[model samples]
Target chain A: MQWSHNMRFFQSYAMKKQLWIIVVIIIAAILPTIIGAFWINVAVEILIMGLFAVSFNMIFGYMGQLSFGHAAFYGVGAYTVGLLMAKLSIPFSLSLIAAMLSAGAFALIIGYFCIRLTGIYFAILTLSFGQLIYYIVFEWYSFTGGDNGLQGIAAPHLLSSVTAYYYFTLVIVIAALIVMWYISRSPFGYTMRAIRDNANRTRFLGINVKRYMLINFVIAGAFAGLAGGLWGPFNQSISPDLLNWTESGIPVFMTVIGGSASFLGPMVGSIIYTFLNAFVTGFTQYWPLIIGIVIMLIILFSPGGIQGLIDKWYKHSDSSDENIEL
Target chain B: METGGRNSGSKSEREEITGESMDFSLIFSQFLSGLSRGAMLFLIASGLSLIFGVMNILNFAHAALWLVGAYLAYTFWNLLQPYGFSLWVSIPLAAVALSAIGWAIERVLIRRIYNRTLSEQLVFTFAMILVIDNLIKIIWGVQDKAIVRPSIVASPVFIFGAPLDSYFIFVIFTGAVVAIGLWWFLSKTKYGHIIKAAVFSREMVSALGIPVPKIYTWVFVLGIFLAGLAGGVQAPIGSITLGMDNAVIIQAFIVVVIGGFGSLLGTLVGSIIVGEIYAFSILFWPDGAMILIFVVAAIMLIIRPWGLFGTPMRT
Candidate 1:
């Protein structure tokens, strides 16, 4: 009787989580209808970045592998789509797919070598590569437009309307997030967390720890690429700076700001960053100053961010999952 | 952004004013140019490499320090413009001023997170990039500023078959002097040996009653001095702008990687290699040079792992 009652409670909680996602989708789908195109553009950017940050969180939070070159994938996706449309006159969907493949291929090649180093070595190595990509884009004037970047990229007919584009982006992001959420809950996630908590123990348990990390790495790179792919049509242009180390820092900032441990934190962090940028930069050119200071204070104080704060509040009220580690 | 050029170039030059205008002597001048550029690179990369060695922190702000040095030189030059002593006086003054800034950076910002993760180090330094660059723009106004080699009536000297600029020669000489100074400081002096001792074993050094944190501050200050000197020397050669920090800093990191961390000799050699690549690439294929160096650094790391002379990771 006691076991059956616990099972029933678990099922009820699972159902509530699923319903929560649906509610979010419904609200997100109708958001642009209520707001203007300007806000919608900001929303689109935030959505793309949310996917990027969440993808980053998978590696940084779940796997405890910090990468400063995530922008390589992001840039590869954006540039792949941009180059295809610029030169080959490829279809929108096809270009996006190509973008994802290119990003994955690029990630695997870099990761093959980078995986050898752990800790700060790995981070700096990735960073150098990220800057290298940026330089390629900046200097390869003949092919990459030589820093002027690819201009005049436009959304496809289906995505011509802001409302339509918002809905389209929302659908894709929702599907991606659902997939990510599922992956996070699967046995794979358990193994990942184990590896993060103690790599030697997991390896002792017969897991190919490096292989597990590589799989998560490629997957993270692909989703970040997907974010980059979406950015192409939305912005209608791309630049090599998109893959620079500084640009790669975004998701890390967002991941930490959103509390990397929780799946929902990064998405919320992205929303917060976007909304803040919308109002803040409009007021002055020195907005990064304000944003940087705020993030510093957040890191210094909260460490786990808003989700971290929420967890602490919930903890005081006696939640069932008391073992949450930020 | 594609700055529109030929998707397919014409078979021949549209206008060739050249009738074998090349000079064999240009090779010597090119070598001289390479050395000068190498010196500037050495100054920047050495500072960055040292910081990486002792602190085990990848500072994103070193390039900003370079920018600050150049800006200080510019400001001092303007203040002392009417007086003939400005050019000679400004460089040392620029370096000294920036040392205080470096001290503040170490004490206030970097000290706070000495024990944090690499991601935290990266994030905090990155924040400085935003704050520092914006501070530069706010203070200087967003206009390009130039630091012309203080009007010293410099003349070119002929070496082998080519004439080399005096300023270029000075840069090369400055680099050598700095290298020797650093080496002697590290080897002969007690403090220098203590730093290397700390580098070899931080805990052992600390257990021996030395203050590791104080050593870190000194390392940071010394590194800052070198970076400021680099900026002061390069003032005449390049543009002084807020964002120049990013380019210089990235290049410095690449050099540090190739040279291996904490090895000044490696930094010097690495700078020369990168410098030669820069000079020759511009002479030949301009597009892929910068990217090619990065590719080289990546390949070097794969092969050597710890860099050419870098100490193995004991941490």
Candidate 2:
């Protein structure tokens, strides 16, 4: 009887979450129509970057390992698509798949070694590996275009317009988010949380800790690649900068800004970050300084980020309601 | 004559790939170049290692600060350009100025994050890099700044048929003095022992009534001072420009990792290894130098995460 009651409670909570998402989707679908072309471009960027940040949070928030080189996978994904379409004349859809696959493959190799150590060592190893890839891409002028970057990557006729690209990104991003949401709610996700909370105990329970972490890392990398795949055609080009360490910091900034504890925190972070980037750069070139000051304030005053702040407010209101009822 | 003949015989084999004859003079020159390169790296990495070793904060903004030091040195030298001793005077002055700035940063920003999660600390410092870099651009403008070297160290010096820039000798000399000075401070001085103790267990040091926060501030200041000195030393070697810190910070990180975090001797040794690898690799594989360094760093990280001289502490 108690189990049944708990199940009902969970079901209603899930229903509320689903309803909220539906409302959000409706708003997103209408956003391009209401906003100007410039804002529409910004929205597309927000969606792609949001997806990237969400993928990053899989390893960061769930698995509790900071992969500083995550941008390597993203870069690989972009390069895969860029090369496929530009060189082999592959279809956009097929190139994206290739991007995901290539990014995952790279992740498997890199993550295999990275999962051996935890904390700062993991971060450094990932960074070194990322730099390794960056140099390869940077120096291979004949193949990867070196510092010149790959140009003339046009999207399909259907997604050539900014509005069309925004819709396409919205659909793909929604699907990716749904898939990730299910993964986060699955038993595998719980197992990751267990490992994060207490790796020793998780091992004692006869789980393969390293294997699970590696799998998580690969999944995150693949998703980041998916986001990267979207980037090349959207921007009409790709560069070696996509895989640079500075690019890796983008998702990190988003995750920290949004709140790493919540599943959708990074997405929220991407929205605020990308939107502000678009808005701020319109006026001044000191975007980095401004963002730096904002991040500093956020870290100093509210380490939990925007989601954490909202959750606190919600809980505070809930307590007041209980007080009134009593 | 026999050695020369043997070298000539092998030169044809090497020349096909490298396009340069492998001779005693070439090898000796490369070795000296590597030594000077290693010394510069040592100057930068030692402070970075010390800060991370004691404070448990891996500062991402370190190279940016180092860049700031270089810019400050330029400004100082520019002011004193009329004097012959300008370059010599500016280097120490820049380091002292940087120490003051370091102390302010520690008290204001770093002190708050002492107990935060590792990611938070890393992100904070990363953000600092962005802010600091931009500030550098605003203050110094986007143009590259070059310092003219004094006559004393203006020309190339020949050692055993190898020509080296005279300023590099000064850089090497400064590196050695700083390395020795740091070793003495860490090993022989009372505060150095306190710092060593703090690295092992901060709580215990604090429990013993030693001001851990004060130690942290001073250590940070000292580290920044070294960075400043390095920057001042580096300014004349090449033109100081925007985005120079980006490449250097990563290289320094590699140096610290290869040496083992918090190990002074390891940093020195690792710097030399990297320096030699970088200098020599340019001969055989010019394009692959950076790639080779990264590969070596990755291998070191995989095989011995604790590094050569560092003992494994917390996971």
Candidate 3:
């Protein structure tokens, strides 16, 4: 009887989750109609950055490692698409694939060196390697256009309209998120959680901890690159700054703000962060100061972030009337 | 010592281009420049090492604080410009000011997050950087501030026929004095011993009635004080500009990593190696200099994650 009661509770929970997802998607579909062109652009950014932050959470949330150089992969992805589209006149779809492949390749190399250590050492190594890539891109004037950055990256005619681009990004991001969601639910995902919770114990259980970490790292990099690839045609330009340490901090901020424990936390964080960025910059130039204070508050008072807050309230409401006696 | 190497500037340039027939004096000058660079790094990184070593809190705001120090030094120097020893007075004053700020930060913010996760601690400090940097913008504006050197060290000094920047001598002297001073304090003082014990086990030290939080506050202040001093010393070397801390902070992190965390001798050696590497690489491969330093640091991290002088027990 108790088991059945628990099963009913979980079933309702899952149904509610699916219902919420559908509602969000429907809202997203009609968003361009309701909002202005300016907001449409911001929505596009929210999707792209949301995808980036989620991928970063693959390391931070699931794998339990902090990668300060995640932007390197993002930057590489952007540069790949920017160069391919602008220089070779490659189709946008092909360019994005190339971006993912190239970013994955770089991650494979950088991650091989990075996965050897954990904790602060991991963060520092990734940062150094990221800077190495940044310097190369910054200095290689002939190929990368140096500090001038690559300009004139126009989207294809089909995506030329802001609304069309928004829809396109929506489709791609939703597909990516679904794939990541499945991965997070799979046995492989459970293994990652095990490794995160206890690496030594997981090793004793015959799981290859390092190999799993490296694979997760590469997957995260590829998705971040995909997000980066989308950015070039949308923004119409790409700079070395995209791959910088500061840029890497963006996804981290989003992940923290949204709540790392929940899968969709980063997306929610992206909504709040990107919207606030668009709104705040309109009036004041002290956006950094504002964001800094917000992050500090989140860390100090609500370390679990907005999602954590919601989860707490949710459990509170559920347990009040439906307390099960075990 | 051949006078020919000194006279023929074009010849040396040609030699540099061709990568052949390098003069001894040119190498000596590079070495001296490297030494000065190392000294500057030491001034910034030693404090970082100390804070991380004792508190286990990697202060991402260390560089930002250093930048603040530079701006403070400029402000003090500007106010005391009529005085002959204005630069000297301003440097220490800047350091003292930074110490006060550090104390406030420790009491209000850092003290709250002593038990938070590593990522939380990192995020907190990182946020501090953003707050501090923007505050600086609001206060100092965007314009670059340059300090004029006093007549005492205004001109280049001949060091073994190399025209070394005279102010660099002062920088090197200050670095050595601080390093020796830090070494002595850590080894010789009662508070220093308590701080070391806290690093090993904060609970044990607290159990012994040492007030570990007080030590943490002072250590943080001490770290920021060094950063401020480094900034003041750096003021006369070039224009104090916004975002200078961005580059220095990364390099300082590299120095701390290369030097074992918590080891004074290690930080010294690491700073010199980095300083020299940067100096020589700029001579041969200007574009690759920063890249090479990063490569070395990555290699060190891979092989010795704790660093050369750091114990594996910390890891």
Candidate 4:
């Protein structure tokens, strides 16, 4: 059996090209279960953060906003779920739903105020909102456990099996990614790209630019929150550190490292970053310094990022296009 | 963001009625404490503003210069401590040493990134912050170190019927001197005029044969040196620690935001406002103070996105 370049390449034996990507996703989902537990867990982190970074790209790459405070939504998701399960006796699945909605709601409010600003002002406003959330979480000691963080957050018993959890996460990731992919290709995405490419031109076209910005911003926040929901149960806890500006930068860095413009670029970057982080921490205490240096070098020299490098190499070697979907 | 909701809680009123202890003379000392911190903030912030305004480079690693100053001050103080050299002497020497370090950073790392966007500049500077902070940790260890207070500053001075530490007076003096010197440099000198012109239009200035890149290098070096000087002056009052860089940078950032990004007078007014707020808030509401200042900033941003004194950018 041979793989077809296009599902619609043959008129009678046709489907959509996106289905090929879905098939690849299905293979990725199953391959992890057969892998070792540690690798599976690491794959889960990559998937989650990959999702997180891509969500960030919606605002940063597509909308031309530079947010230094996205961890606000991520942390809200974590803490919302953590507090709900701990205090309100909410079911885990419902808690995740509630967490995502509330996070989206918060993003909507923050995005409403923030959409009015542009460039660095938008960055600062988002940051201030993030800091405000950090303050509340840090100070509300009795409820959020303050700096110590809420601990011992157990998932449903079915997810106690690492492989089971892997499959479960794989399914959710596929769903989430599809939703995000759909969002990016939708009319909304086109308008966002227009706004990013030329705000003045888009405004002159009679589009409700700020309204479109808020919609995408809230959607991105929702996906980020969903990613955070995965994180809390996987890690068994959430801390204020998860919500800080530094944590926010991880997604930004990974997105940049992976190639923010590509759909699957963040996934690739997260895998490399996570693996490198684990390995480097084992070898030396100064991991952040090394990582920081690498990030700087990459940004300065390789503006197109890892995916960009691969694309350049491919183009250089062959006149015919042989490119990865991402 | 909690929006300063008008339905005031009891906690809000409780914030309005706090009193100072009879050991209240310590209050004046603490007021000085805030002033010195304010001065340090001004030093770092003014440099950051200049780098932002003149170079159009939001170089986050500029914070590292403060750490460099503090570290150099620590080393100098240790060497001179055995010889009985006061912090006064060590600080100036350390400031000079850090100026050289600033020159090196400009020549090596910063000069290369002048053509980059603000986001790219931010990434470069962020990495530098991490690398420099950790290099200091590796060399100095994670432990904190302090410069000895000069004997003159150890003595108390009478002010407004309150006793103040002489070191506080010294801090105020250094801040005043630096502020005046910076004013003279910016407002009363030909170089200042060139830098201002460069700030507004790099291409036009370079077209006129002003050596714009050289000016950029000088501006960055001078900015970092001023930050280092601030750090050096702060060494006697505080410990030099790796994490010290973070808080100082944030405080500097707030000052920059409050001061109008590129204005020196704005930095001064902003620092004083923030300093006084922090000082009074400690007495009133311990937890709410920092958040309140940010709240003030958020409001300012909404009302005048350019800041109190900053000119609005052309979109």
- Interface RMSDs of the predictions, in order, are 1.6, 0.6, 0.8, 1.5
Candidate 3, which segments miss by more than 4 Å at Cα?
A: A1-14, A317-326, B1-22
Name the lDDT value of residue A184 in candidate 1.
80
Worst 10 residues of 4 chain A by lDDT: A315-324
Quick one: best TM-score, which candidate?
Answer: 3
What CAPRI grade goes to candidate 2?
medium
| DockQ top scorer | 2
Better of 2 and 4 by DockQ: 2
- Put down candidate 2 lDDT per residue, B1-315, tens digits, no spaces: 333233344444434423344366578778878888999889889889999999999999999999999999999999999999999999999999999999999999999999999999999999999999999999999999999998878877554444568788798899899999999999999999999998889999999999888999999999999999999899999999999999899999999999999999999999999999999998999889899999999999999999988888865
lDDT of 4 by residue, A47-88 (tens): 888888988888987787888889999999888888888788
Report residue A119 deviation for candidate 4 (angstroms): 1.2
Better of 3 and 4 by TM-score: 3
Better of 1 and 2 by TM-score: 2
Q: Model 1 off-target regions past 4 Å?
A: A1-23, A317-326, B1-24, B153-158, B161-163
Instruction: Report fnat, model 3.
Output: 0.74
| Cα RMSD, each candidate | 6.8, 5.2, 4.0, 7.4
Cα displacement (Å) at residue B284, model 4: 1.6
> Which candidate, 3 or 4, has the higher lDDT?
3
Clashing pairs in 1: A145-B1, A145-B2, A145-B3, A147-B1, A148-B1, A149-B1, A149-B2
